[model samples]
Target chain A: MSEILLQIDGREVEARKGMTILEAAQSAGIFIPTLCHHEKLEAYGACRICTVEVEARGRKNLVAACVYPVEQNLVVRTRSEKIDRIRKMILELLLAHAPDAFALQDLAKEYGADKDRFEKEASFCIHCGLCVRYCAEVKKKNAVGFVDRGTRREISFIPEIASKECWNCKECFPLCPTEALQAAFVLTKALFSP
Target chain B: MPRINSATELEELRKGILSKRDPNKPCIAICAGTGCLALGNDRVISAFEEEVKKQTLEAKVDIRATGCHGFCEKGPNIIIYPEEICYIEVTPEDVPEIVSQTVLGKEVIDRLIYTDPNTGEKAAHQSEIPFYKNQMRHLIGNNSKIDPKSIDEYLALGGYSALSKSLFEMSPEQVLEEIKKANLRGRGGGGFPAGLKWETARNAPGEEKYVIVNGHEGEPGAFMDRALFTGNPHSVLEGLIIGAYAIGSHQGFIYTRHDSPQLRNNIAVALTQAEEYGLLGENILGSGFNFNVEVHLDIGIFVSGESSALMRSIEGKNPEPRPKYIRTSVSGIWEKPSNLNNVETWANVPQIINRGSEWYTSIGTERSKGTKLISLSGNIVNTGVVEVPFGTTLREIVYDIGGGIPNGKKLKAVHFGGPMGGSIPESLLDTPLDFDELAKLGAPIGAGGMFVLDEDTNMVDVTRFFLNFLTNESCGKCVPCREGIRQMLKIVTNISEGKGREGDIELLEEISEVAGAASLCALGKTASDPLLSTLRYFRDEYEANIKEKKCRA
Candidate 1:
């Protein structure tokens, strides 16, 4: 693999071929806040919180540091006021969906996003893609997958029908970043109580 | 007759036995699934045996304990072959008359037969019964025909022929090609192509590749895998052996949960039996392929269901998930190339190989080809395992197969895909059981656990219960899952307890993003699915709890 030269957080650095921006930043001891990227599984740029401004081949754009492989002469910004604001907004949006989610709360605190201004949507879907990734990548069950387009897109067992292949194992619920998947025990009480 | 080893051989064996016996001889198949066993089906079996013995009609009568018949509401059940006479709710005391009248006289037992709640007509035959008639039972249909304990019975039905053919005739590459042709995907939760996984492990740069069978069914109210383990262990073993051969693996392990003692014992017995018959160890079936299998009991941790966690348990480490970038097929279970598949996924291999890929593909939707075995439980009439072709609608499953909500209760939301799966409201009940279909609805077909919720259920409380579960089960290695789930739980609990704040919902969405984006494993990433999906579809319920300080039904 050829060594790729890049500028991270305005500091010049060299990275190996195919190394992600996150990897490049981490090797340089530059911390980029992230939520969905795991070192063990394939990089899922679902959270989009790890976005970074990258200038490659004279073209500048924001991309997920976890999934974006480093190229030669790539200029990357790990931290900036704009990036911080976007990161904070992402956290705030996540909080709107899952207010009690401790992980997001901590990230909010770390990013200095203490209060959210947007009207809270009645939804638990943070759109993390764990359920989609697991179904397609891990279990290979393919009984469910991501369907439709972005924003309106969500995980389903089938395209137009509620899945019969779904064993109801609840594996996806735990993998869901938002509490879109509800457990039966909670639903039972929710149904009965006035 | 010589001992049979495969499903093909079993079919021949069945033919031979049928050739000699009187075609008119009554064949009684008792429901021997674990659920039925819990209701004292064993005693019922014994009573029928004694009655047959007392009547001196052993030669003319054949009684076998078959796998789950799928109708669990009215077990212990018995279905007489040829006539297809269906008997439900049979107790030990009802055995004498069953043997004397049904077995001896060939008369239907009206009292024990299932009466359709709507029609008021007694279902005398298994085929005529609405529970069995309304749904497709492609995978589990065999459960009604073969005895799980008797490999001979399975072989007599031609069970292991697929393995035999794969070993003796087909090359490893050929096996992979066949699987690819079938388009058989993993039946666990992840629906990646099974053949692709085998090919990856086979072609990966390694001298040793391992195959691990995941029997760690930790999902609440799910028991399909357990039923397969307990009832038909050999079928799964045969599939594993084929997988091992394809991947060039010498050793394999069945990582079973500790809770199921009967399943564990059944698998042990099957392994011992296979080994004795030269079907499991040291060059099985006189073929050059050498494969060995062992059942590794898990310590009953929910996290063990995760691939990394399952691998950790196999390696004598605490059941905790490792980082994700390293693919198990590349570096797993002692850092060797490993192919890990759930019990049901393995079981489908032999069927696909034997029946041919096109036949398998013809059953389900375009993307999701073949049938899926789902454990249908919670607020339903028929709480048992059903194998239906992919793309079957939730309405069909809950109504046709599950016999709808019990006691005429209105169906509110159907919780598919377990904890990690989202709940579908009644509006989306028409969604089919396919990979892409459910994904579009913001839910995935998890390990095939479907919990039907009645109109009386509360969505907010349901979200809290799952949050509580994920919080407790979090490996705690990542801050997002550990702290994030805890905070989500607190907020959801507050809403459920009528103490939610105006800004609480926004707070939850933020936390969900962090957990989804930052969590190291699937556990944390999807920990918020229940809450998120509920918020998307049932936001009114959350708002009612938060604003009105009450759960509105």
Candidate 2:
């Protein structure tokens, strides 16, 4: 791979041409927050928490650090006023879904995000797709998957697959940012068990 | 009929078709478009057929059920040939008199012609009608001339000549160059240059490239794509085939909506007819350039209209849009170079090739070239598909062609692009229909869905209505769009219900910035456009609902 030279938060970093800004920052030990991204699996740019300011070829844009590929002489800002506001609003919005999600609460404290900035929906699932991708990509079980679309989208454990494989391999349980995954798995087990 | 083998044979076939048709034949062209069909043009069509047979004038007076005539408000519409006499709101009972007086006697019917409601002036001929007169009709003008299902009629109208010209006369590079010089921007939305996109797909390192026709006209008020595709399917197919040749693609896909059986049937028939005529498939017109096409139907969602999502749907996967940091032209549909354009954009390709770039550039404005097919709906007096050059002003479309607003209600705002687009207030009605011009006024001419709102229409309710639609249609892949729209909808709904707080507008703007900037795809990015544009022009209405608990509409 050709070596790519770029800057992250004003610090010089060396990355490969195919590397994403998140991967480059991680290699250089720079801090960036993420919710739906995992190193073992492909980048799912669902949660916009890692949205960073990027400038290349005299054009500046806000892109998810996980999916935006690194370029030669690219400038990336991990934190900015605009980015922080986006992250803060994201935290507040996600909080409405899962009010007690510990990961969100930690970010909420840091970003000064209100727990009830909007109406409380409390669906308990933020639709991170972590459990789904983990089951499908890492474990190769395909036990959990996304169901429906848009605001009603949620992760559901497939009863046919989960009942057979998820009994011993609770691998996706801890990956959930909230209790929704475990709750879903338990519900599926109870509903499908003979 | 045997398959045409060469340009000479194609020309011979065209001549053979033309020789059989007489220019002065008294053909009763009935409007059987979706609008007219809904208004019971099918009964009228059957009535005309029976009347012609009963009168034993079937051979002399030809009854052709053509496509949309554009004056939808007055449909079931018909235009008699030779004299070009126009009739509106035709019924089954009127079919007999139409056949006798108009077709047989060549006498114009006084009561059936278009009478302007505002001016009380009568227009007997189709050209005299203000709606048809104002339009340039470069694309949809043929709807009233030819029957959609008849390949012979299309050939008589100079259909596949563009394809023949491109294959026999011009090289692919020359074809691409002409399109580039013509500056034909995408009519679907975004107004991106079609030539540049084709060049990128052509240059992308790949042996297999694909082109797609986005027939998924999911915009609520937009039906022009359907009118053009269904009425003149061959025109769009011819354009798609020519585009495939120019882009050096062996395969192309037509992705249309699963609804509208007429549209799907017309496209299916068009494809089969083109293949049989050797205008498509292997060794098209015996030019040794092999290409084929397949028709795919969307699973029925607005998001499926997004280029990436449409490509994904074609791949038999869930139709979700990917971040287009890398253009789809470089990597799409199983990682092959793919060029996707809307149905209207593809339909314009054949015209650019048939007419030289200079002739094509003679019309429209500085950047935008050629005519745009706009579907006018809502409070307008005339709700139908209109085709006008790009430089035409909104006032011309609204006042002249649209016949102004109905019920003498004052015009409020004209919303373009459906749920994903913005609106322009009455003050900006003079803004040209050019892509950049309307975009500058915060209302992009997206797929050309012009919805007129009257004085009684509340802008806040309208914004909320569009948001509610998006909230259900959103694919929920990203946080900024799904959750952000949820919160924004909550605020807007509350504001519309007179429960908005003092800082709700600022909060909505802040969320719009984040959603607009941080979202992964175009759906999320443009989801807030309606709210932002309404807030831009009609802030006082929102303020009135919030501060005084009253609606200003």
Candidate 3:
């Protein structure tokens, strides 16, 4: 791939064409925080923690670094007051759902988010989509998926398919950011796997 | 019956249809729109038919079910031809009197006429009525003339002539130039210029581009698009074909409300009929340009109206809006350029082409050209869809067309737009309905739903209602919008319930700014608009809720 020159946090970086801002920042040795993003999978912009101000062609707005591909003459700011505030707010919300997830707690502490600003939601999944993606994309089981939508959206297991296809495959267990899926994987393995 | 091969054959068909219609024939046009249908207009229709047969006036008189006549407050309504006499709240029992007296005896029915509140005078004619007067009904007025089910009725009113003109006469480039010169902004909330979006999609790379007609009018109290789509769907379809021709898109989609089966069916029939006549699909009217359209229903959420999310929904994915860094107009729906416009914006296309761009530009304000369809609802004497020019003041709409606030109550404020919109206090009622002017006053003409609030209405409560609506409707994929709206809703609810803290408003503002700036899509970015605008204008109400623990009248 041909390399394109771009600026990240006032420093120059050469990134291959079709490389995302997050990837470019990583290659340039600049640290940028991310959630709902995995190197082995496609960019899932669900968590929105890697938001950065990107300016290109006289236009600028906040974009998810994971999904936004780097281009020639592109300028990106990885951190700012607006960026931090958004990240903090997102963490504050995330903590309400998966408050005990150690990575989320550390991220929250780094961003200095308030703990009780929002009410807690009832789920441990936190909607990272890592497990869902791993199960669907890598494992090729198609056993777990997101159902419903909006605030009520939750990751639901199709028991009929999971019972048939997921007994031996513990592949999605190690990929989850939270340990919510480990017990289910063990239960499926113990009950169904010969 | 065969596919029309040339514009000449299309015109000849239109001529044949028009020549067969008798102008002097006495016809009864009954509204079968959703609003009228709810009031059992179908029964009224059957009653009229039965009464007409009983009276032996079947051959001489024609009773046809038309679309919404716009004055939905006084339905089920009927407009008689040859004199344009309007009858309101028509019932099956009244059908005999209407047929015997109004149609046969050539006399007026005083009890059925709409009485003017101010003058204490009754109006029988459609044009003379205050609700229909003092306004420009360019797009919606056609609903009263044609049956939405019949293409013949639409043709008799000179419908596809605009398409014929655009396809046979003007080049695609010329059509784009006219739309650009007309400065027709999207009637969708953002008010972005329609021509600029079309030009972007037309010029964007990739041979396959898609044009979308957003019929998901899920905005609270906004049934204008639904009326337009359900009443005269062919107008919207004809407009879509013209837009596709201009944008060089062979494929199009009309995404409408999934709950409205009538709307879905009407559009389905329109598409089938249009295709049958060679108006759509494979070399439309022998112009060597081909276009085809499909109808898709929405996921039934308010946020699905966002362009990006709607595109995702059409792609058979969850209707969650992603950050539009690529700007959906250029790269949307399977990563191809897709040009999407609101139902009203597309409906205005035919009018712009039929009348020159100069003619279209002559109406409305300097910046926002063309007349807008405003759905007048909430605490008003007349709650229905009304079409008026852009520069018309809120005062005129509230007092004249809306028939003033109900039950002699003092005017409190007017809420424009829907959940993502703001309210205009009665003190600023003279604010014109122009896009820039209303936006300058902190109110945007979102979906053109003009909800009038009165003395008893609580401003804080109004804002709280909208926030709660958005909180539920949000896709929850993004953090700021999902949590920020939830937090704002909590604060607003606390303040409304008299348990608010001292720093609650400041906290709300901080969250608003973050959510408005950082959120992934338009739903997240503008999620705080209703709360912010209310705080800007009605700060005293919030303070009262916090300090005094009481609501202000």
Predicted structure with the largest TM-score when compared to the true one:
2
- Cα-based RMSD of candidate 2: 1.5
Number of the candidate with higher TM-score, 2 or 3:
2
User: Which numbered prediction scores highest in DockQ against the true structure?
Assistant: 2
> What lDDT does model 2 reach?
0.91
Name the lDDT of candidate 1.
0.78
Candidate 1 per-residue lDDT over residues B474-537, each given as its tens digit: 6554445655776788888888999988989988987787667556677877888888889999
Task: Report the lDDT tens digits of candidate 3 across residue range B270-353.
Answer: 899888988999988888889999888886888788899899999998787876768788999999999999999999999899
What is the clash count for each candidate, in the order shown?
Answer: 141, 2, 0
Q: For each model in turn, which proportion of the native inter-chain contacts is also found? A: 0.00, 0.94, 0.58
Rank all candidate structures by their lDDT, best first, as comma-separated numbers: 2, 3, 1
RMSD of each: 12.5, 1.5, 2.3
Model 2 Cα displacement at A66 (Å)?
Answer: 0.7
Best by lDDT: 2
Write one digit per residue (lDDT tens) for candidate 1, span A65-170: 8877787778888777766866886676567667766667778887887545444654455556566566557766654554433123444454222234344554
